[model samples]
Target: MDRPLVAVGSVIFNGDSVLLIRRLHPPNQYKWAIPGGKVELGERLRDAVIRETLEETGLLVEPRTLMGIIEVFKEGYHYVILDFICEKKGGELKASSDAGDAKYFTLNEIRKLNVSSTTLEMLERFWRGEKMPFMITEISK
Candidate 1:
Protein backbone atom coordinates (compact mmCIF):
# COMPACT_ATOMS: atom_id res chain seq x y z
CA MET A 1 0.00 0.00 0.00
CA ASP A 2 1.13 3.56 -0.75
CA ARG A 3 0.26 6.62 1.29
CA PRO A 4 0.20 10.05 -0.26
CA LEU A 5 1.76 11.93 2.62
CA VAL A 6 2.09 15.48 1.25
CA ALA A 7 -0.13 18.54 0.86
CA VAL A 8 -0.92 21.91 2.39
CA GLY A 9 -4.06 24.02 2.91
CA SER A 10 -5.18 27.23 4.55
CA VAL A 11 -8.18 28.84 6.24
CA ILE A 12 -7.96 32.48 5.25
CA PHE A 13 -10.35 34.76 7.13
CA ASN A 14 -11.68 38.29 6.82
CA GLY A 15 -13.29 39.15 10.14
CA ASP A 16 -16.23 36.72 10.54
CA SER A 17 -16.09 35.56 6.95
CA VAL A 18 -13.51 33.16 5.58
CA LEU A 19 -12.16 33.46 2.08
CA LEU A 20 -13.09 30.72 -0.37
CA ILE A 21 -11.78 30.26 -3.88
CA ARG A 22 -13.48 28.38 -6.64
CA ARG A 23 -11.20 25.90 -8.33
CA LEU A 24 -10.64 26.69 -11.96
CA HIS A 25 -9.05 23.30 -12.53
CA PRO A 26 -10.56 20.06 -13.62
CA PRO A 27 -12.46 17.74 -11.22
CA ASN A 28 -13.30 20.61 -8.84
CA GLN A 29 -14.92 22.95 -11.32
CA TYR A 30 -17.63 25.20 -9.90
CA LYS A 31 -16.78 23.90 -6.46
CA TRP A 32 -15.58 26.23 -3.67
CA ALA A 33 -12.70 25.76 -1.26
CA ILE A 34 -10.14 27.60 0.81
CA PRO A 35 -7.18 29.02 -1.15
CA GLY A 36 -4.41 26.43 -0.94
CA GLY A 37 -2.79 23.46 -2.57
CA LYS A 38 0.07 20.97 -2.28
CA VAL A 39 3.41 21.85 -0.73
CA GLU A 40 6.17 22.00 -3.25
CA LEU A 41 9.43 20.17 -2.76
CA GLY A 42 11.88 22.19 -0.62
CA GLU A 43 9.16 24.73 0.16
CA ARG A 44 8.48 25.87 3.68
CA LEU A 45 4.99 25.03 4.94
CA ARG A 46 4.00 28.64 5.55
CA ASP A 47 5.65 29.75 2.35
CA ALA A 48 3.79 27.13 0.34
CA VAL A 49 0.42 28.32 1.65
CA ILE A 50 1.41 31.93 1.10
CA ARG A 51 2.48 31.25 -2.43
CA GLU A 52 -0.55 29.11 -3.23
CA THR A 53 -2.92 31.76 -1.90
CA LEU A 54 -1.34 34.49 -4.01
CA GLU A 55 -1.25 32.34 -7.11
CA GLU A 56 -4.87 31.31 -6.67
CA THR A 57 -6.42 34.55 -5.40
CA GLY A 58 -3.93 37.26 -6.41
CA LEU A 59 -3.95 38.52 -2.85
CA LEU A 60 -0.86 38.44 -0.69
CA VAL A 61 -1.50 36.99 2.75
CA GLU A 62 0.50 36.53 5.91
CA PRO A 63 -0.49 33.33 7.62
CA ARG A 64 -0.86 33.57 11.39
CA THR A 65 -1.12 30.14 13.03
CA LEU A 66 -1.65 26.65 11.77
CA MET A 67 -5.23 25.78 12.72
CA GLY A 68 -5.18 22.08 11.99
CA ILE A 69 -3.86 19.22 9.86
CA ILE A 70 -5.98 16.54 8.26
CA GLU A 71 -5.16 13.16 6.83
CA VAL A 72 -7.67 11.98 4.28
CA PHE A 73 -7.42 8.45 2.96
CA LYS A 74 -9.40 6.99 0.10
CA GLU A 75 -8.76 4.38 -2.54
CA GLY A 76 -5.35 3.65 -1.04
CA TYR A 77 -4.13 7.23 -1.22
CA HIS A 78 -3.53 9.67 1.63
CA TYR A 79 -3.98 13.43 1.53
CA VAL A 80 -2.08 15.35 4.17
CA ILE A 81 -3.25 18.90 4.64
CA LEU A 82 -2.02 21.80 6.69
CA ASP A 83 -4.78 24.24 7.45
CA PHE A 84 -3.49 27.66 8.43
CA ILE A 85 -5.25 30.77 9.72
CA CYS A 86 -4.16 33.71 7.65
CA GLU A 87 -4.90 37.39 7.06
CA LYS A 88 -4.66 39.63 4.04
CA LYS A 89 -1.27 41.23 3.77
CA GLY A 90 -1.47 43.12 0.50
CA GLY A 91 -2.43 43.07 -3.21
CA GLU A 92 -5.65 44.11 -4.90
CA LEU A 93 -8.35 41.48 -5.17
CA LYS A 94 -8.03 39.46 -8.33
CA ALA A 95 -8.89 35.95 -9.38
CA SER A 96 -6.29 33.94 -11.19
CA SER A 97 -6.23 30.97 -13.52
CA ASP A 98 -6.27 28.54 -10.65
CA ALA A 99 -9.17 30.16 -8.85
CA GLY A 100 -12.23 31.09 -10.81
CA ASP A 101 -13.48 33.36 -7.99
CA ALA A 102 -12.46 34.56 -4.54
CA LYS A 103 -14.39 36.19 -1.72
CA TYR A 104 -15.07 36.15 1.98
CA PHE A 105 -18.14 34.63 3.56
CA THR A 106 -19.56 34.20 7.01
CA LEU A 107 -19.69 30.80 8.66
CA ASN A 108 -23.36 30.53 7.81
CA GLU A 109 -22.52 31.10 4.19
CA ILE A 110 -19.98 28.30 4.47
CA ARG A 111 -22.76 25.97 5.54
CA LYS A 112 -24.60 26.87 2.36
CA LEU A 113 -21.55 27.07 0.13
CA ASN A 114 -20.61 24.14 -2.09
CA VAL A 115 -17.19 22.74 -1.27
CA SER A 116 -15.23 19.56 -0.85
CA SER A 117 -16.13 17.58 2.25
CA THR A 118 -12.70 18.10 3.80
CA THR A 119 -12.76 21.82 3.10
CA LEU A 120 -16.19 22.24 4.68
CA GLU A 121 -15.24 20.28 7.74
CA MET A 122 -12.08 22.32 8.18
CA LEU A 123 -14.06 25.55 7.92
CA GLU A 124 -16.55 24.49 10.57
CA ARG A 125 -13.83 23.53 12.99
CA PHE A 126 -11.95 26.74 12.31
CA TRP A 127 -15.02 28.92 12.94
CA ARG A 128 -15.28 27.67 16.49
CA GLY A 129 -12.03 29.52 17.42
CA GLU A 130 -10.82 26.85 19.75
CA LYS A 131 -7.07 26.29 19.82
CA MET A 132 -6.95 22.64 18.93
CA PRO A 133 -4.12 20.20 18.66
CA PHE A 134 -3.51 19.45 14.99
CA MET A 135 -6.31 17.03 14.19
CA ILE A 136 -5.43 14.05 12.02
CA THR A 137 -7.97 11.64 10.53
CA GLU A 138 -8.25 9.07 7.80
CA ILE A 139 -11.31 9.27 5.57
CA SER A 140 -11.59 5.66 4.57
CA LYS A 141 -14.04 2.91 3.77
Candidate 2:
Protein backbone atom coordinates (compact mmCIF):
# COMPACT_ATOMS: atom_id res chain seq x y z
CA MET A 1 0.00 0.00 0.00
CA ASP A 2 1.16 3.52 -0.77
CA ARG A 3 -1.05 5.75 1.32
CA PRO A 4 -3.69 5.38 4.00
CA LEU A 5 -6.76 3.93 2.32
CA VAL A 6 -10.23 5.12 3.18
CA ALA A 7 -13.04 2.60 3.58
CA VAL A 8 -16.67 2.78 4.62
CA GLY A 9 -18.78 0.34 6.57
CA SER A 10 -22.28 0.10 7.97
CA VAL A 11 -23.72 -0.95 11.29
CA ILE A 12 -27.19 -2.06 10.36
CA PHE A 13 -29.89 -2.93 12.81
CA ASN A 14 -32.87 -5.22 12.27
CA GLY A 15 -35.04 -5.11 15.35
CA ASP A 16 -32.61 -5.82 18.18
CA SER A 17 -30.00 -7.55 16.08
CA VAL A 18 -27.11 -6.23 14.04
CA LEU A 19 -25.98 -7.43 10.64
CA LEU A 20 -22.43 -8.72 10.24
CA ILE A 21 -20.31 -10.55 7.69
CA ARG A 22 -17.47 -13.02 8.03
CA ARG A 23 -14.67 -11.58 5.97
CA LEU A 24 -13.00 -13.89 3.46
CA HIS A 25 -9.83 -11.81 3.25
CA PRO A 26 -7.45 -10.04 5.56
CA PRO A 27 -6.65 -7.82 7.50
CA ASN A 28 -9.24 -9.71 9.52
CA GLN A 29 -10.28 -12.59 7.37
CA TYR A 30 -12.82 -15.16 8.59
CA LYS A 31 -13.90 -12.99 11.50
CA TRP A 32 -17.32 -11.39 11.76
CA ALA A 33 -17.38 -7.66 11.21
CA ILE A 34 -19.55 -4.90 9.81
CA PRO A 35 -20.31 -5.14 6.10
CA GLY A 36 -18.18 -2.75 4.09
CA GLY A 37 -15.16 -2.38 1.86
CA LYS A 38 -12.76 0.13 0.37
CA VAL A 39 -14.38 3.20 -1.09
CA GLU A 40 -14.29 3.50 -4.83
CA LEU A 41 -12.71 6.42 -6.61
CA GLY A 42 -14.93 9.52 -6.65
CA GLU A 43 -17.55 7.75 -4.54
CA ARG A 44 -19.24 9.64 -1.74
CA LEU A 45 -18.74 8.14 1.70
CA ARG A 46 -22.42 7.49 2.27
CA ASP A 47 -22.74 5.98 -1.17
CA ALA A 48 -19.78 3.76 -0.45
CA VAL A 49 -21.38 2.53 2.75
CA ILE A 50 -24.61 1.68 0.99
CA ARG A 51 -22.89 -0.04 -1.90
CA GLU A 52 -20.46 -1.96 0.29
CA THR A 53 -23.19 -3.21 2.58
CA LEU A 54 -25.17 -4.44 -0.41
CA GLU A 55 -22.16 -6.03 -1.99
CA GLU A 56 -21.10 -7.94 1.11
CA THR A 57 -24.40 -8.72 2.76
CA GLY A 58 -26.91 -8.76 -0.09
CA LEU A 59 -29.02 -6.17 1.74
CA LEU A 60 -29.85 -2.60 0.81
CA VAL A 61 -29.33 -0.02 3.53
CA GLU A 62 -29.64 3.68 4.09
CA PRO A 63 -27.03 5.39 6.18
CA ARG A 64 -28.59 6.91 9.28
CA THR A 65 -25.67 8.39 11.20
CA LEU A 66 -21.90 8.42 11.37
CA MET A 67 -21.10 6.20 14.29
CA GLY A 68 -17.34 6.58 14.44
CA ILE A 69 -13.99 6.01 12.76
CA ILE A 70 -11.53 3.20 13.29
CA GLU A 71 -7.90 3.10 12.23
CA VAL A 72 -6.39 -0.35 12.04
CA PHE A 73 -2.75 -1.31 11.50
CA LYS A 74 -1.90 -4.96 11.38
CA GLU A 75 0.40 -7.26 9.46
CA GLY A 76 1.46 -4.50 7.09
CA TYR A 77 -2.14 -3.41 6.46
CA HIS A 78 -3.60 -0.02 7.31
CA TYR A 79 -7.20 1.05 6.99
CA VAL A 80 -9.01 4.16 8.14
CA ILE A 81 -12.60 3.06 8.31
CA LEU A 82 -15.66 5.21 8.68
CA ASP A 83 -18.59 3.40 10.17
CA PHE A 84 -22.22 4.41 9.91
CA ILE A 85 -25.26 3.26 11.71
CA CYS A 86 -27.73 2.34 9.02
CA GLU A 87 -31.33 1.40 8.53
CA LYS A 88 -32.12 -1.72 6.62
CA LYS A 89 -34.15 -1.05 3.52
CA GLY A 90 -34.66 -4.29 1.63
CA GLY A 91 -33.12 -7.27 -0.19
CA GLU A 92 -32.54 -10.85 0.86
CA LEU A 93 -29.59 -11.42 3.18
CA LYS A 94 -26.80 -13.70 2.00
CA ALA A 95 -23.02 -13.83 1.91
CA SER A 96 -21.45 -12.49 -1.26
CA SER A 97 -18.44 -10.62 -2.52
CA ASP A 98 -15.60 -11.05 0.00
CA ALA A 99 -17.91 -12.25 2.73
CA GLY A 100 -17.76 -15.90 3.64
CA ASP A 101 -21.03 -15.60 5.61
CA ALA A 102 -23.59 -12.96 6.53
CA LYS A 103 -26.23 -12.89 9.21
CA TYR A 104 -28.00 -10.81 11.82
CA PHE A 105 -26.64 -11.35 15.29
CA THR A 106 -28.03 -10.28 18.59
CA LEU A 107 -25.72 -8.56 21.07
CA ASN A 108 -25.50 -11.73 23.08
CA GLU A 109 -24.68 -13.79 20.05
CA ILE A 110 -22.09 -11.26 18.96
CA ARG A 111 -20.15 -11.50 22.21
CA LYS A 112 -19.78 -15.20 21.63
CA LEU A 113 -18.43 -15.01 18.11
CA ASN A 114 -14.92 -14.37 16.85
CA VAL A 115 -15.40 -10.76 15.77
CA SER A 116 -12.88 -8.26 14.55
CA SER A 117 -11.63 -6.05 17.36
CA THR A 118 -12.77 -2.89 15.69
CA THR A 119 -16.26 -4.27 15.25
CA LEU A 120 -16.47 -5.26 18.90
CA GLU A 121 -15.25 -1.91 20.15
CA MET A 122 -17.41 0.12 17.78
CA LEU A 123 -20.53 -1.84 18.61
CA GLU A 124 -19.83 -1.61 22.31
CA ARG A 125 -19.48 2.13 22.17
CA PHE A 126 -22.56 2.40 19.99
CA TRP A 127 -24.64 0.28 22.32
CA ARG A 128 -23.58 2.45 25.20
CA GLY A 129 -24.87 5.50 23.34
CA GLU A 130 -21.45 7.11 23.43
CA LYS A 131 -20.70 10.33 21.64
CA MET A 132 -20.65 10.28 17.86
CA PRO A 133 -17.59 10.39 15.64
CA PHE A 134 -15.43 8.74 18.24
CA MET A 135 -12.06 7.41 17.21
CA ILE A 136 -10.58 3.98 17.82
CA THR A 137 -7.03 2.90 17.11
CA GLU A 138 -6.04 -0.75 16.89
CA ILE A 139 -2.62 -2.19 16.11
CA SER A 140 -1.72 -5.85 16.02
CA LYS A 141 1.29 -7.93 15.08
Candidate 3:
Protein backbone atom coordinates (compact mmCIF):
# COMPACT_ATOMS: atom_id res chain seq x y z
CA MET A 1 0.00 0.00 0.00
CA ASP A 2 1.19 3.50 -0.77
CA ARG A 3 1.14 6.30 1.78
CA PRO A 4 -1.29 9.08 1.14
CA LEU A 5 0.22 12.32 -0.20
CA VAL A 6 0.15 15.31 2.14
CA ALA A 7 -0.90 18.73 0.81
CA VAL A 8 -1.54 22.22 2.15
CA GLY A 9 -4.00 24.93 1.14
CA SER A 10 -4.58 28.47 2.36
CA VAL A 11 -7.50 30.84 2.52
CA ILE A 12 -5.43 33.97 2.11
CA PHE A 13 -7.29 37.16 2.81
CA ASN A 14 -6.74 40.73 1.64
CA GLY A 15 -9.24 43.02 3.30
CA ASP A 16 -12.75 41.71 2.58
CA SER A 17 -11.64 39.49 -0.30
CA VAL A 18 -9.89 36.12 -0.49
CA LEU A 19 -7.22 34.92 -2.87
CA LEU A 20 -8.07 32.14 -5.32
CA ILE A 21 -6.35 30.28 -8.12
CA ARG A 22 -7.59 28.60 -11.24
CA ARG A 23 -5.97 25.17 -11.27
CA LEU A 24 -3.85 24.28 -14.24
CA HIS A 25 -3.76 20.53 -13.69
CA PRO A 26 -5.90 17.54 -12.88
CA PRO A 27 -8.26 16.69 -9.99
CA ASN A 28 -10.45 19.69 -10.61
CA GLN A 29 -8.46 21.21 -13.40
CA TYR A 30 -9.70 24.57 -14.66
CA LYS A 31 -11.65 25.09 -11.45
CA TRP A 32 -11.08 27.88 -8.96
CA ALA A 33 -9.75 27.03 -5.51
CA ILE A 34 -7.51 28.36 -2.77
CA PRO A 35 -3.78 28.54 -3.46
CA GLY A 36 -1.94 25.36 -2.44
CA GLY A 37 -0.28 22.13 -3.53
CA LYS A 38 1.53 18.98 -2.36
CA VAL A 39 3.83 19.26 0.66
CA GLU A 40 7.37 18.27 -0.08
CA LEU A 41 9.23 15.81 2.14
CA GLY A 42 10.67 17.29 5.37
CA GLU A 43 8.62 20.48 5.00
CA ARG A 44 6.57 21.75 7.94
CA LEU A 45 2.83 22.10 7.36
CA ARG A 46 2.83 25.86 7.90
CA ASP A 47 5.86 26.25 5.69
CA ALA A 48 4.27 24.12 2.99
CA VAL A 49 1.18 26.31 3.01
CA ILE A 50 3.25 29.45 2.65
CA ARG A 51 5.46 27.97 -0.04
CA GLU A 52 2.59 26.54 -2.04
CA THR A 53 0.67 29.79 -1.81
CA LEU A 54 3.70 31.71 -3.04
CA GLU A 55 4.37 29.26 -5.80
CA GLU A 56 0.84 29.39 -7.06
CA THR A 57 -0.05 33.03 -6.46
CA GLY A 58 3.25 34.88 -5.98
CA LEU A 59 2.09 36.11 -2.60
CA LEU A 60 3.88 35.79 0.72
CA VAL A 61 1.46 34.87 3.44
CA GLU A 62 1.47 34.09 7.13
CA PRO A 63 -0.66 31.18 8.21
CA ARG A 64 -2.95 32.48 10.93
CA THR A 65 -5.15 29.47 11.78
CA LEU A 66 -5.49 25.78 11.06
CA MET A 67 -8.98 25.76 9.67
CA GLY A 68 -9.40 22.04 8.90
CA ILE A 69 -8.05 18.84 7.38
CA ILE A 70 -9.63 17.00 4.47
CA GLU A 71 -8.85 13.62 2.97
CA VAL A 72 -9.39 13.23 -0.75
CA PHE A 73 -9.38 9.86 -2.47
CA LYS A 74 -9.95 9.41 -6.16
CA GLU A 75 -8.92 6.57 -8.43
CA GLY A 76 -5.60 5.41 -6.96
CA TYR A 77 -4.63 8.79 -5.53
CA HIS A 78 -5.15 9.69 -1.90
CA TYR A 79 -4.27 13.01 -0.30
CA VAL A 80 -4.52 14.44 3.19
CA ILE A 81 -4.90 18.21 2.91
CA LEU A 82 -4.29 20.67 5.71
CA ASP A 83 -6.24 23.88 5.29
CA PHE A 84 -5.21 27.20 6.84
CA ILE A 85 -6.46 30.75 7.09
CA CYS A 86 -3.69 33.16 6.10
CA GLU A 87 -2.94 36.88 5.94
CA LYS A 88 -1.03 38.39 3.07
CA LYS A 89 2.43 39.62 4.02
CA GLY A 90 3.78 40.83 0.65
CA GLY A 91 4.39 40.14 -3.06
CA GLU A 92 2.41 40.99 -6.19
CA LEU A 93 -0.56 38.95 -7.44
CA LYS A 94 0.29 37.02 -10.58
CA ALA A 95 -0.50 33.49 -11.70
CA SER A 96 2.54 31.32 -12.07
CA SER A 97 3.79 27.82 -11.32
CA ASP A 98 0.74 25.59 -10.69
CA ALA A 99 -1.92 28.24 -11.30
CA GLY A 100 -3.37 29.40 -14.58
CA ASP A 101 -4.79 32.55 -12.97
CA ALA A 102 -4.94 34.11 -9.52
CA LYS A 103 -7.06 36.88 -8.07
CA TYR A 104 -8.87 38.17 -5.03
CA PHE A 105 -12.61 37.79 -4.82
CA THR A 106 -15.35 38.78 -2.41
CA LEU A 107 -17.59 35.98 -1.13
CA ASN A 108 -20.37 37.00 -3.48
CA GLU A 109 -18.01 37.07 -6.43
CA ILE A 110 -16.67 33.66 -5.50
CA ARG A 111 -20.12 32.10 -5.60
CA LYS A 112 -20.31 32.95 -9.29
CA LEU A 113 -17.28 30.88 -10.25
CA ASN A 114 -16.76 27.22 -11.06
CA VAL A 115 -15.30 25.74 -7.87
CA SER A 116 -14.98 22.45 -6.15
CA SER A 117 -17.62 21.49 -3.61
CA THR A 118 -15.09 21.12 -0.81
CA THR A 119 -13.67 24.54 -1.61
CA LEU A 120 -17.14 26.05 -1.69
CA GLU A 121 -17.96 24.57 1.69
CA MET A 122 -14.75 25.83 3.19
CA LEU A 123 -15.33 29.30 1.80
CA GLU A 124 -18.85 29.36 3.20
CA ARG A 125 -17.58 28.40 6.63
CA PHE A 126 -14.84 30.97 6.36
CA TRP A 127 -17.30 33.70 5.37
CA ARG A 128 -19.46 32.84 8.34
CA GLY A 129 -16.41 33.17 10.64
CA GLU A 130 -16.99 29.64 11.85
CA LYS A 131 -14.21 28.05 13.86
CA MET A 132 -13.71 24.69 12.23
CA PRO A 133 -12.52 21.59 13.97
CA PHE A 134 -10.28 19.22 12.00
CA MET A 135 -12.22 17.26 9.39
CA ILE A 136 -11.44 14.23 7.24
CA THR A 137 -13.12 12.96 4.09
CA GLU A 138 -12.68 10.16 1.57
CA ILE A 139 -13.89 10.68 -1.97
CA SER A 140 -15.60 7.57 -3.33
CA LYS A 141 -13.96 6.13 -6.38
Candidate 4:
Protein backbone atom coordinates (compact mmCIF):
# COMPACT_ATOMS: atom_id res chain seq x y z
CA MET A 1 0.00 0.00 0.00
CA ASP A 2 1.14 3.51 -0.64
CA ARG A 3 -0.64 6.38 1.11
CA PRO A 4 -3.94 5.69 2.78
CA LEU A 5 -6.72 5.94 0.25
CA VAL A 6 -9.94 7.87 0.85
CA ALA A 7 -13.18 5.98 0.27
CA VAL A 8 -16.90 6.37 0.95
CA GLY A 9 -19.68 3.94 1.87
CA SER A 10 -23.43 4.25 2.12
CA VAL A 11 -25.75 2.58 4.61
CA ILE A 12 -29.19 2.45 3.11
CA PHE A 13 -32.02 1.39 5.34
CA ASN A 14 -35.56 0.31 4.57
CA GLY A 15 -37.72 -0.11 7.62
CA ASP A 16 -35.66 -2.59 9.66
CA SER A 17 -33.36 -3.77 6.89
CA VAL A 18 -30.02 -2.54 5.61
CA LEU A 19 -28.46 -2.87 2.18
CA LEU A 20 -25.25 -4.86 1.81
CA ILE A 21 -23.04 -6.12 -0.98
CA ARG A 22 -20.77 -9.11 -1.24
CA ARG A 23 -17.37 -7.81 -2.17
CA LEU A 24 -15.66 -9.47 -5.16
CA HIS A 25 -12.21 -8.01 -4.55
CA PRO A 26 -9.45 -8.48 -2.03
CA PRO A 27 -8.98 -7.01 1.48
CA ASN A 28 -12.43 -8.37 2.26
CA GLN A 29 -13.35 -10.58 -0.63
CA TYR A 30 -16.75 -12.26 -0.53
CA LYS A 31 -17.64 -10.51 2.70
CA TRP A 32 -20.96 -8.76 2.92
CA ALA A 33 -20.44 -5.04 3.46
CA ILE A 34 -21.84 -1.63 2.66
CA PRO A 35 -21.51 -0.56 -1.00
CA GLY A 36 -18.44 1.58 -1.43
CA GLY A 37 -15.05 2.16 -3.06
CA LYS A 38 -12.10 4.51 -3.14
CA VAL A 39 -12.83 8.08 -4.12
CA GLU A 40 -11.67 9.43 -7.43
CA LEU A 41 -9.47 12.49 -7.28
CA GLY A 42 -11.39 15.76 -6.88
CA GLU A 43 -14.66 14.03 -6.16
CA ARG A 44 -16.69 15.15 -3.15
CA LEU A 45 -17.27 12.61 -0.38
CA ARG A 46 -21.07 12.60 -0.73
CA ASP A 47 -20.82 12.18 -4.50
CA ALA A 48 -18.41 9.30 -4.10
CA VAL A 49 -20.81 7.56 -1.75
CA ILE A 50 -23.73 8.03 -4.11
CA ARG A 51 -21.76 6.94 -7.16
CA GLU A 52 -20.24 3.94 -5.43
CA THR A 53 -23.62 2.77 -4.17
CA LEU A 54 -25.09 2.92 -7.66
CA GLU A 55 -22.12 1.23 -9.27
CA GLU A 56 -22.05 -1.62 -6.81
CA THR A 57 -25.72 -2.16 -6.04
CA GLY A 58 -27.53 -0.51 -8.96
CA LEU A 59 -29.34 1.76 -6.51
CA LEU A 60 -29.42 5.49 -6.93
CA VAL A 61 -28.99 6.93 -3.46
CA GLU A 62 -29.22 10.34 -1.83
CA PRO A 63 -26.87 10.73 1.07
CA ARG A 64 -28.79 11.96 4.10
CA THR A 65 -26.29 12.01 6.91
CA LEU A 66 -22.61 11.57 7.61
CA MET A 67 -22.56 8.35 9.58
CA GLY A 68 -18.94 8.24 10.62
CA ILE A 69 -15.39 7.27 9.75
CA ILE A 70 -13.87 3.85 9.57
CA GLU A 71 -10.11 3.45 9.37
CA VAL A 72 -9.15 0.05 8.04
CA PHE A 73 -5.70 -1.50 7.86
CA LYS A 74 -5.18 -4.97 6.52
CA GLU A 75 -2.88 -6.92 4.20
CA GLY A 76 -0.74 -3.82 3.68
CA TYR A 77 -3.76 -1.84 2.52
CA HIS A 78 -5.14 1.16 4.32
CA TYR A 79 -8.33 3.08 3.73
CA VAL A 80 -9.97 6.03 5.44
CA ILE A 81 -13.63 5.45 4.80
CA LEU A 82 -16.36 8.01 5.24
CA ASP A 83 -19.69 6.38 5.85
CA PHE A 84 -23.08 7.98 5.20
CA ILE A 85 -26.71 7.21 5.76
CA CYS A 86 -28.42 7.18 2.38
CA GLU A 87 -31.93 6.95 1.01
CA LYS A 88 -32.75 5.01 -2.12
CA LYS A 89 -34.02 7.36 -4.75
CA GLY A 90 -34.34 5.01 -7.73
CA GLY A 91 -32.97 2.05 -9.69
CA GLU A 92 -33.30 -1.69 -9.23
CA LEU A 93 -31.22 -3.71 -6.83
CA LYS A 94 -28.60 -5.96 -8.47
CA ALA A 95 -24.96 -6.80 -8.12
CA SER A 96 -22.49 -5.04 -10.42
CA SER A 97 -18.99 -3.68 -10.52
CA ASP A 98 -16.97 -5.15 -7.65
CA ALA A 99 -20.00 -6.59 -5.90
CA GLY A 100 -20.72 -10.28 -6.35
CA ASP A 101 -24.14 -9.96 -4.74
CA ALA A 102 -26.38 -7.26 -3.31
CA LYS A 103 -29.41 -7.42 -1.02
CA TYR A 104 -31.14 -6.04 2.02
CA PHE A 105 -30.90 -7.88 5.31
CA THR A 106 -32.44 -7.51 8.71
CA LEU A 107 -30.05 -7.39 11.61
CA ASN A 108 -30.89 -10.95 12.63
CA GLU A 109 -30.29 -12.24 9.13
CA ILE A 110 -27.10 -10.23 8.79
CA ARG A 111 -25.63 -11.87 11.89
CA LYS A 112 -25.73 -15.20 10.10
CA LEU A 113 -23.88 -14.11 6.99
CA ASN A 114 -20.19 -13.70 6.19
CA VAL A 115 -20.34 -10.01 6.98
CA SER A 116 -17.48 -7.64 7.54
CA SER A 117 -17.00 -6.90 11.23
CA THR A 118 -16.94 -3.19 10.62
CA THR A 119 -20.27 -3.41 8.83
CA LEU A 120 -21.81 -5.64 11.45
CA GLU A 121 -20.70 -3.37 14.25
CA MET A 122 -21.99 -0.30 12.54
CA LEU A 123 -25.38 -1.81 11.92
CA GLU A 124 -25.58 -3.00 15.47
CA ARG A 125 -24.84 0.47 16.66
CA PHE A 126 -27.39 1.97 14.35
CA TRP A 127 -30.05 -0.46 15.46
CA ARG A 128 -29.37 0.31 19.08
CA GLY A 129 -30.18 3.99 18.45
CA GLU A 130 -26.66 5.00 19.25
CA LYS A 131 -25.40 8.45 18.40
CA MET A 132 -24.12 9.26 14.95
CA PRO A 133 -20.56 9.87 13.70
CA PHE A 134 -19.25 6.76 15.40
CA MET A 135 -15.57 6.18 15.01
CA ILE A 136 -14.26 2.71 14.21
CA THR A 137 -10.92 1.10 13.54
CA GLU A 138 -10.48 -2.31 11.96
CA ILE A 139 -7.09 -3.99 11.73
CA SER A 140 -7.23 -7.38 10.15
CA LYS A 141 -4.53 -9.96 10.60
- Every candidate's lDDT: 0.77, 0.90, 0.85, 0.90
The true-structure Cα RMSD of candidate 1 reads 2.4
Candidate 2 stretches greater than 4 Å from native: none
Q: Model 4, residue 9: what's the lDDT?
A: 94
| Predicted candidate 2 versus true structure: per-residue lDDT over 7-117, tens digit per residue | 998988878899899999987888999999999899999899989988888899999888999999987988999999888899899899999999899888999999987
TM-score (C-alpha) between model 1 and the true structure: 0.84
Off by over 4 Å in 1: 26-29, 74-77, 136-141
Q: What are the per-model numbers of colliding residue pairs?
A: 0, 0, 0, 0
lDDT of 3 by residue, 25-104 (tens): 86678999888999998999889988998889888999998887878886577888888988889989899998999988
Ranking by lDDT: 4, 2, 3, 1
Clashing pairs in 3: none
Q: Pick out the ten consecutive residues of candidate 1 with the lowest summed lDDT.
A: 1-10
Estimate, for each residue in 11-75, the C-alpha lDDT of model 1 and write its tens digit: 77667788888887733458897788878789998899889988888888887888887777755
Candidate 4 clashing pairs?
none
Model 2 alpha-carbon miss at residue 57, Å:
1.1
Choose the strongest candidate by TM-score: 4
The TM-score ranking, best first, is 4, 2, 3, 1
RMSD (Cα, Å) for all candidates, in order, is 2.4, 1.1, 1.7, 0.9
TM-score of each: 0.84, 0.95, 0.90, 0.96
- Name the lDDT of candidate 1: 0.77
